[model samples]
Each structure stands twice: as structure tokens, then as C-alpha cells.
Target: MQQLLAPIYSFLQCETPDSWIEEAKKPEQLKGLLIDHCNCELKAAQTAMFLVRKYAIDKQSGQLLLDWAKPYENFVYIKNRDIGVFLSKGSKKNELSGELVARKDFAHSDDLIQKMVRLIKEEFHHFEQVLEIMHSRGIEYQNVRAGRYAKGMMKQVRTHEPATLIDKLIVGAFIEARSCERFAKLAPYLDDELKKFYISLLRSEARHYQDYLKLAQAISVTDIGDRVAHFAAVEAQLICSTDQDFKFHSGAPVLNVTA
Candidate 1:
């Protein structure tokens, strides 16, 4: 376990809490947790799509982005086919070949294409792994509404050129970092299967957050540390504050009295 999560811990700015881990490990909670995680994977991919459309890709490429996300979204939201077949058919291994990565015009497109393409691949793989675990345990999947966490953070993005782009990248860093932190925190409390899975995800996710930061720096001619610090405070507030929703990335619990 230490072997798996050590790199994740070293890469992130924050640590996971014991309480969240405890809650995540409960056998009874596995189904809901996995479902929420599945949702997170799809959302992560969509977020990458938005970045590609807004910054990296041309219109036709933008359409391709939607095309890529649609099938995975279908499997998660609609569950239209067997998990194994769906995974095999829609996987991104073909799209992320070294040649494709080299052909990308990072000057015109930024690192958005290569970075997001790899991220999409990893997120989809994680989605498949979660599905396998659920299937092995006979846990039926279901759709759940998104929590307020990400939306709340994104609401803070400024409306302008490079500032907006820079802010979005900063926000992206926080989201990925927080996800890494949570995965580590939640791992120990989870059962053997999930604990292993979350730990495995940490390294890639840690790199992802770093990738966002690097892109932000590359795009801006000026120092961005101040901007990064600003968003970190904002992101910390959202994570540390009270939230009514229960999700993989939601903030402090707000009494699930209805549940």
C-alpha cells in the first residue's frame, strides 16, 4: 500500500483525512462509492473536452471530443451495453499513440491535446476498473446527480482572455490535486479491492494536476504563482465548507437527513 501511494503523497499539496477513509471502506458503501467514482471519471473526461474545445482543438476536433465522450457517457448514464464490450470498443489507446502526441501543435493548441488525451485515457481505464469491481461484486450501477463542488469552484473563473484561461488551468490543478488527496485519504478505509484501485490511480492523477500547472505556466508570459495561490485558497474553502451533497468530491457533510 505504501509502495502504491507514496508517489501520490509526494506529488500533492494536501493529505487525505482518516475519517473520509473510514467512511469509504465500509462494504455496504462500496456500491454507491463506486458509482460516484464512475461519475467522476466521466466528468473528468468532459472537463478535458471543454479544455480542448476552448483552447486546443479546431471545430472539427471539438466535434471529435464530443464523439469520444459520448460513448463512455452512454455506458455510465444509459448502461446500454455490457461493460467489457463497451470498454473495448471505446478505449483511447488508438488515439494516444506516440505519433499523435508528436503531431500535436502545442504552440497553437497548447499541451491541452496531449495532456487531455492521456487524461481521458486514464479516466476511462479507471472507469472500466471500477465497473469490473462492481460487476464482480454484483453491484448494479445507477446514475446520480452531480454535486455542487465542481460547479462552485468553476463559478469563480474570471471572464476574459489569458486570465480566464489561466484561472481555469489553476482551477483544473486544484481539482486534480484534491482528487489525488481524496483518493489517498479514502484508500486505507476502503476494502482491499477499492484500496488497491485508488492507490493505483494516485500516480497518474498526481501527474495530471502537475500537467495542468505546467500548461498554465507555459501559456502565461508573467508569473502565475499569485494566481495559483488565490485559487488554492478558494478551492480549500469549497472543500472545507459545508455542502448538502454526498459525492466523491463533495465538501463537509450537511446532514443527510433525507437519506
Candidate 2:
């Protein structure tokens, strides 16, 4: 595991704060933590789906991606939260219905679709996995408002072509890296089942970060080292600074509500 995480550890400018981990380990916080985690998994899939649809695929193929996400969306946003119906509906399945065609004249289109589709598939599966854990634990899934971690990183995205896309990809990399780091940090404190699940996430999460970094580099005309460093600083601040709400990816807890 250390081998897989070595690069992730070096990539991020800071670790998840000890205060955040302390709040996360509390028994009372498990419900909210897992609920937010379930939401996070779905959001990760949607983000990848959005990237593929917006930048890489055709309109029809993009529609297909949206259609694929609909059932899961209904379950979360529509408050269905029916695991039975979701499985019966086959929304948990990972395979795409048809090949996704790239947009005309875009060199990186195929690569973006390839990486993002794979990411979307895995994320969807992870979402289902988290949902199952929640069900088993009797934790109800609900819409958790997104914390500032992502929005704060996204605020750094440039508004121009290629630069915007590249910045988004860099942000994706940092988010994935932080997820992997937090999973590692939090795993040991969880029970056997949750610990195994969190540890299982490390490999794919690490690869997701690398995938985003490679795509950003491939799409950019120039090196992205400085951009990566810039986001690294921003991401670190978001992690280490005081945050009001405590989600899975939230910053240091402002107060120990559990106390």
C-alpha cells in the first residue's frame, strides 16, 4: 500500500488535519461521514461523466452518458434511495451501452473519454458499494451540500481554452489524491468491514489522480508543473484551514461537536 501511496503522499502539499481525523473517528459521526461519502462517490462519477460529455463525446453519446446517470440521480436527488429498485433497475452496472465517439478535430478527445469513462465506471461502483454499507449500517442516504474543498479548488480554474480544461484536470488530480490520502489516514480507525473498503479504494483513487495529471499534461501545449504546484498550494490551504462543516473531505473541524 505504501508503494501505491508514495507518489500521492509526495503530490499533496499537506496531510488531512489531525483534527478532522479526530472528528471522523467518533461513533456519533459515522452516520454523517458515511452519508457524505455516499454522496461523494456519486459526485465523482458525475464529474467524470460531465467531463466526457462536455469536452470529449458527441451530442448523442453525451445523451447516453446522461441517461446512464439518471437512475442514480433519481435515487439521490429524487430521494428514492431504494437500493432494491436501483439494483433491479440495473443502474449499478458499469459497462457503457455503446461506444462513445469523440468530437471532430479534437486530438485529446479519445484519451479524455477513455480515462474519464473508466473513472466514471469505477466511481459508480464505489457509490453502490458505499450505499450498500450505509444500508447495512442503517444509515440513510441524503443530499449533503458540497463543502468548500472542491469549490475552493475550482475557483482557481482559468477561463480560457485548454487552460480551463487543464486547470480542471489538475483540480481533479488534487481531489483524487486527497481522497486517497484521507482514506489511508482514516482506514485504521474504522471497523473491519469499513477498513477493508477504504483500503480497497486506495489503488483506484491513486490511479485516478495519475490519470487526471496525465490527461492535463497531454492536453496542454506547455508543461503543467507550475499549474500543478499552484493548485497544490490552494488544495493544501483548503485541507489545513478551518472549515465549518464536517464532510468526508472537509477541512479541520471548527468545533468538536461530538464532544
Candidate 3:
């Protein structure tokens, strides 16, 4: 467990609990955690689509990606009763094939498509896993409005090509890295099933951060390390500061009068 968690701990600037195993096995705290995670998976798919549209593909493919995300997004962001049952199927049931249509003027485009597609597939799978866990406990899924976390980071993206692209990718890296870090941190505080679930995500989430970094490097002609650091500061502020909403990526909870 220590070896599996080393990267997550290092990234988050924290240590894993020696007692996490016991906390995770608890039956309480299961529903809220899994539901939040299900919402997170859908959001991950949306983030990947944003990348594909803004940087990778032409307009038509971009729209297609958006359309693919629509149903899942509706499941999470809009009211839908079957969401829990729909997602409760299984993530380990099938392998996703990576074949994509060829394109014109497609230098570096296919790579982005491949990466985004794979990410979407994984996010969907994770969404299903979370749903399945919820079903096992008879918890219904509900749509929760997103907090300001990701938008706060995205607002820092530059408004120009390549620069905009680079910043977005760097932002993507931070989001993935933070998600990996938070998963590890929250795992120990969660019940047994959720602890294992979050821990299971660590490796893939770490790799997702590295993948975003590699893509950023591949696309940028300028050194992006400084830009990455700048966004990291912004992202950290967003994560560590106070927030009124209590979604998955929200900061410290603030009471919402609407709630």
C-alpha cells in the first residue's frame, strides 16, 4: 500500500495514514462519497472533451465529442432516475478499442484524440463503478451543481492560440494531479469500500497527470514549466481556500443558504 501511494502522497505534500485500512472498511460514509465520485467521473469526461475541442480536432469531431458527453452529462448535471442503475453495471466488464477515423492536416491530432478517448472511456468506467457501489447500498444518484473549483482554475487560461492551449494543458495537469492527491487524502477518512476505490484510482490518476504534461510539452514551442507553476498557485488557492459549496472538488465548506 505504501508503494502504491508514494506518488500520490508526494504530489499532495502529505503522508498516508498507517490506519487507513481500518477506516475504509467502515459501512458508514459510503453513499455520499460514491455519489460525489460518480459526479466526478462525468466531469472528467467533460474536461477531456474540452481539450479535444479546443486543441485536438476540427469542429465536427469536436461537436461529436460534445454530443457523446451529452448523455453522461445529462445523467449527472440534469435530473435522471436511472443514472444509478445505468452506472452500476461494471467497469471491468469490457475493453475499449482505440481505433479512430483518419483525418486531413492531422499532425498531432490523432494523439490527442486517442488520449481523450481513452480518458473518456476510463472516466465512464469509473462512473459505472461508483454507481454500482451506490446501488449495492441502495443509494440513489442525484445531480449536484458544480462548485467553483475548476472554473476558478480555467479562468486563468490565456485567450490566445498555443498560449491558450498550453495554459489549458498545464491547467489540466494540475487538475489531474490535485484529484490524485485529494483521492489519497480523502481515502483514509472514508469507509473501507471507498478507501479501496480511491486508492485504486491513484495509479491511473497519476498517469493522467503525466499524460497531460507530455501533451503540453509536445504542443508548446516555449518552456511551460513557469506557466505550469503559475497555474499551480492558482489551483492551490482554489483548493485550499474557503468555498460555499461542498461538491467533490470544493474547498472548505461554507454554508449555502440555498441548500
Steric overlap count per candidate: 2, 0, 3
Against the reference, the lDDT scores of all candidates come to: 0.72, 0.89, 0.68
Ranking by lDDT: 2, 1, 3
Residue range 134-174, candidate 3, lDDT tens digits: 77877888765666977898789899887877777777777
lDDT digits (tens) for residues 1-259 of candidate 2: 9999999989999999899999899999999988888888898999889888889988999888988887678788775457666656554356677888899878999899889988998998898889888877777778888899989998899999989999999999998999999999999999999999999999999999999999999999999999999999999999999999888888899974673
Could you tell me the lDDT of residue 255 within candidate 2? 79
TM per prediction? 0.82, 0.95, 0.78
Instruction: Please report how far candidate 2 places residue 162 from its true position, in Å.
Output: 1.0
Candidate closer to the true structure by TM-score (higher is better), 1 or 3: 1
Candidate 2 stretches with Cα past 4 Å from truth are: 88-92, 256-259
Instruction: Itemize residue pairs with steric clashes in candidate 1.
Output: 25-189, 25-190
RMSD to the native, candidate 1? Answer: 3.8
Q: Give the top-scoring candidate (lDDT).
A: 2
Predicted structure 3: lDDT: 0.68
The 10 consecutive residues of candidate 2 with the worst lDDT sum are 85-94
